[model samples]
Target chain A: MSSSTPHALAESLCILTLKSGIWVLFPITVVMIMVGILRHYIVLMLQSPPKKQPRAAIREQRALIRSQIIRATSANSPIPPTYYKSISQHLSQAFADGTYLKDGPPKGDAPAPTAPNPLTDPAAMDGMMAGMKTQMVMMVPQMVIMGWINFFFQGFVLIKLPFPLTLGFKSMLQRGVETPDMDVRWVSSLSWYFLNFFGLNGLYRLILGGENSADSSRDMTTPFAAAANIAQPGQAQDFNKLFKAERDNLEFAEGLYSWVGKDVDTRILKKYGRLPGEVPR
Target chain B: MDLTTSLQKLAAYRPKQSQKSKETFEKGVALLEHGGYLKQGDEGWDALERLALAALDQDNLEVADRCLELIAERFPGSPRVDCLIGIRMEATESPDVVLKYYDELLEADSSNAAAWRRKVSVLRKMGKVDRAVEELSALLDTFYTDVEGWLELADLYASCSQYVPILLISDAQNLMSARYTYALQSLSHALLLAPQNPSHFLQFAETAYLAGDITLSLKMFLTVVDMTDDDDGDVSPSDSIPTGMTLRAWFGVKLCTRRLLTEPRLLTSSGSQTPAPSSSNISTLDDLSTERLRTAYLDIKNESPPATEKELIAVLATLIK
Candidate 1:
């Protein structure tokens, strides 16, 4: 490649001269940042506030949450295995009794897969719509800005990253460029923009608060990463399914062991008092 | 008048590194006795609290005992008397006996928030944190508006926090919802209930910093710096906070500022996901003063950070000149 002139090799520094791609960095940055900010606003606007559920439904969700919290908490909870066991038994019975569920067992035939059918439940539909909205917000801007970058600023190496990477990344990062053996550090304008698109959540936090809708720190939410499954609105929460899962979890849990212990950090902090060894010199 | 005035100053000035003279407290007690100001009222209670605290500071357990005696004798039915008795028990009796004593007082007057607070403190001092958390939560259940209870609960949970993963394997989508760190959850509640707490701000800052929310952490750290600096006259009214949180908050400020500047582009670009802002505190967090954060950061960067922040100290030393 013409990049490796004899005199250039003689300089021996990683820094290489480039063209207007350096100038293009600003436009790309502005675009990605704008997209990120726009995405937050869109999500903010589209977000459906949680609907008021029946008292029974609320109680059921809370019971499940309490169980989940306890599971998370037991890692450090001082409550003995006996305490957990009692709690588990109480929860298990509550679930078995169907005490907190809003809907009751049908005239016969094993409670429900439910009447209006959870697959068509309005609440379930709302969740799916919310999920779709988030996906749309993320995808639409991504496509538009990506195409815009491809059309306007195609080829030219931007700044070198501080970290070194394998030569394999050269093709991925310098896509529009065809200089074989060009320094892998030379990223095209589109690649630089992509970098900013994923990265600027922190800066946005600096400018806006962390909770700002525009802070795309969530990055690309893959299906694998979605925290809640947005079922079709018709689909209701299956308490039976939840109960079975909890039964499985409780069976596997250490709740039966039943001896209370001190939280280790509490014990440590008690011993050290203030920031171990932080007594003013 | 002279004695009561000195006692009030002593109460407020105890945060000074220099120790107070025993004579100041002794004279205050004598003056209160001689002037007959030891009756149940704001003056009497303030003087007694100051005297009791000062005597405790001087390790004059005898004097402390006498002060508690006068408070109880005069107040008779006051909840503050139970608190004083609790403090007295801390000095005199074994913690087991004192805990029982506080529990008895609580059984009598379940509505006494002061007694509840004293009970929590005794539990904390005894290192029964699980019990302490329960008591604090009980206090929250009955008196949800009690910001102090929430703050204590948040602190306890923060100390006890350990990241335990949930097996959300039933659905891959469930995996997307990052587990809210329990400490962060309680702290968020406290912030929502009392947005004015500076210590909670510090706690939020330190916790956020630890959790890799650099922007939010920086914002909270800067908030603490602004609040502390703005009220630079006296030891902060933030009596709930121990000296420990201040140390952490200051350390967090130093660390977060450096991280924010060092890899502004890199940190923002890296695919690390910030947990969703489940806390309303973050949702309400608007109009953050970046100018103040930057300026205060530069100013704070010059000072010596705590020994606990050893990593940041090294980074600070090599920071851009």
Candidate 2:
């Protein structure tokens, strides 16, 4: 029984050795071989010719040697430079002739030119003033309405309504406010609030007011009028009238200003004796 | 007969509620004749009531239709019939079917802007953005004051990055709505259109600066500065300034107007492109690198300056070196 026990133990040890070999040793060997092959392939893909490196190294060394030689040779000789004074005299002569003016006092400061007057042209100035008058006329009613609204609801709330509504309903119309009852009326009120405050009314009005003001000022100025006339010759009068009407009108305002601006070419041709594609001087 | 016996005999003789199909039909006919379903005993009102009841009871659209047909036959010219048809069609929960009813409504009344807007919304929900846009554009063409339609088209163009169309429409409307943001976006796209224009590069620089993209702005500015015809001995400040402006004269002033006090060094050797610092504060000054250079430039660009030559020189030495 003792002998048989020893034999069985030996057999078990042999099996254990085989199992560990299969599990660990075999896979590791395979992995190592795969990794080695991959490394080789990557190296091959990245390989460049050795010729370029050696040539670059040689060139660098040559440049270093050349610079050293030049330094050494320059140190060996220190000669008296006779031609320097003659060169300086010739440069001073040329500097005086070319740079330093012979006519004016040397270092004289001249007065600067005056700013150009834009309103000098009588025709352009007259047209601009006319346009200005029209704009003022158009704006009077709007301004009055605005003032009335400002007085009623405080200035801020009055500015909150949509453009055409604000203009149309100024003092007469009382917009319905929502109460606990009437769900439809409440929903509409909420919608109107959201739309007027955040949607576009506030932003649109701000931009419109700014643009109208700028355009009004530009139309009324002589330089701008002259430039406009030059840009579109015959429509100067129409432009003036249109600008005035757009700027001043509170009650019945349209996108006439924008339309006229966009169609300036056509309007000029129709009104004045200007042709399409005609260049303005 | 005795009283008790007579009562019993009468109870037996009297008919119970009718058991035959014919009798049941007669009962229903009587109810109908008496106007059972009608709310106000109006002609067409009863049909809608019956239809609503049929729809509720059976939970089937066909039954609802049968009820509708009875009403339509009874009151041929009734507007309520059309409204009832629309209600039933909408109850189907199918957009196409609902749209069919809306189309009928439109055909009956062309001035119904509400119906048109609803149709457009349904089309948009179905991912028919182009179709919705077309409908809205048509509406806008007829009624230019329809701001909702204009806004919708603008939104569509923006989402699709069809900027030229957006610009064209906004210009036509005479509104610079989202003009700044749109201009910034267009400036970026313009680079794609003309990759080589120096003027375009300058515009890109300005727009990027405005949009708060400092890195892109700096790169664009450097690109334009490099492209000009004037070739200074080095990439000098004189070379960077654009030509044909009184602004060009101001470049020298800007260069000499740094806030920080430092030194400018002239190159002792031909290979050394940068000037050496002559200021005594050279030991304390930060080392020259890309980041330091950029920070220094930014600091100098946004500061109050001294007008005199001596102060300008001191400032320049600090900023440049």
Candidate 3:
């Protein structure tokens, strides 16, 4: 091939490669994510094990009912649960006084399968692992998208204007009174009252509005700075004494006042036999 | 004349003598001996005076009235009948009417402070307190040096709870006998007037303590202790209260009690004095005004949070003593 032709072909290949990459992988990944989420929802909704009744089902039911009866007998007094026939007879016994003995070994069932071995039903385990991985992969992108939608949605509701050109008219209306020599005293003064009247209403509305914000974290710091090293031997003694004296006086006065309407004041007056205002020359 | 012989002679001459003559005789005797049976200068005076006394003794009001009437008609210038009439009016009428007669007696004899005092008592009994006060004022104005009048006026003011007036009146009279009422009222008013004078203020409070207003006493005591310099000289009441307690000392004891018991530090202020109660708690509050203090104590005792009766009594003892 000629040199120019080779160069043109190389440029065309680069363009084609970029277009194919975008077209093929991106769409496939999006489709796979959608499918995985749908599968999770369906499985969560439908999953339940099939029941296999033993040949000695009636004997087993009697034994279960006996144990349930024992539990019900020891249940707290004063209320008998309502009966229902659709539930098992043993459950009925347990339900009689609303007493329930939680089933399963006390120490928890056997350890979870250590490894994905066929004997431990590897297929179910594999499916659970796959679901968990899919959940982990989807979490970050899902959060980013949710945040984006919330931010834009709030912005749209918060800031609505008729058109870009109308902003100029609005700004002029806001600044019109500011031009020199025009008496906009009424406009300027009344603006505060009007804005306050409605601004308060809007602020109250915002506070009571549905919460969609990040949780706040508490600060974990000591209140006082450590650098003030000076100490006074009797710093608070006088203040404490004054505080205690005032507090005691107030308490006594309160007690005295309760007994007599301002009689305590009179009593204090009587005790002091003098007014606080009088200073002996 | 001998009273019995004169009475017999009047009885024998009553039928023979005119009623006017008997009244004249009674008036003549009455002038010389104010409570005599008969007048020496007149006819039939002995019989009438004898008859009046006999009628008054018999409680025969009608006869007494007739005898007094005859005496008055027969001896117009004689005041014996008026005196007799006043006695009869006081005995027969309500206090208000008696007061009127007493007032008349005072008018007739301006110097009759006895009559004025009687009138004051009658007015008071009739609930005419202002009239009683008026009578007292008259006595005070006319008889300024009369200690009796001053004492009576002081009593009247005290009965009415007019403390400040009582204090002023007592101080004016210089009647130290009224120290309790005088001290309390004066101290209270002084506190109101000159609250900053710790010494002067405490003096009145001390007097109140002497007067048996324990709460006020305690207050004044504590105030003195709080306001006075440690080296301040003791000022004692010049006229010692009759109860043998000085206002200053009583207040000091009360101050010491409250301080030692309520605030331990106060006990230490008087060094070497233990925080324990004195050798004896305050004894009986025997002063007349102590009832008011007792009432205040009981009122406060009731309001204190549920305590045993003994505890209440203890608190009350603190207040009254």
TM-score of each: 0.38, 0.19, 0.22
User: What is candidate 3's local distance difference test score?
Assistant: 0.39
Error of 3 at B85 (Å): 6.8
* Candidate 2 structure, TM-score to reference: 0.19
lDDT of 2 by residue, A81-185 (tens): 111122223323433332212122233354533433447755445555544544454345335533443353221111122333333332222233312221121
lDDT digits (tens) for residues A2-92 of candidate 1: 7778645523432443446567777778877877777777788888664544434545555565455445544433232333455557766
For each candidate, C-alpha RMSD in Å? 27.7, 45.4, 41.7
- lDDT, candidate 1, equals 0.56
lDDT tens string, model 3, A107-145?
A: 345453233343255444444444444344334443453
> What share of the reference contacts survives in each candidate?
0.00, 0.00, 0.00
The residue ranges of model 1 lying beyond 4 angstroms of the native Cα positions read A1-281, B1-27, B30-36, B39-42, B161-180, B197-199, B219-254, B257-321
| Residue B95, model 2, lDDT | 80
What's the lDDT for all of these models? 0.56, 0.38, 0.39
Model number with the top TM-score? 1
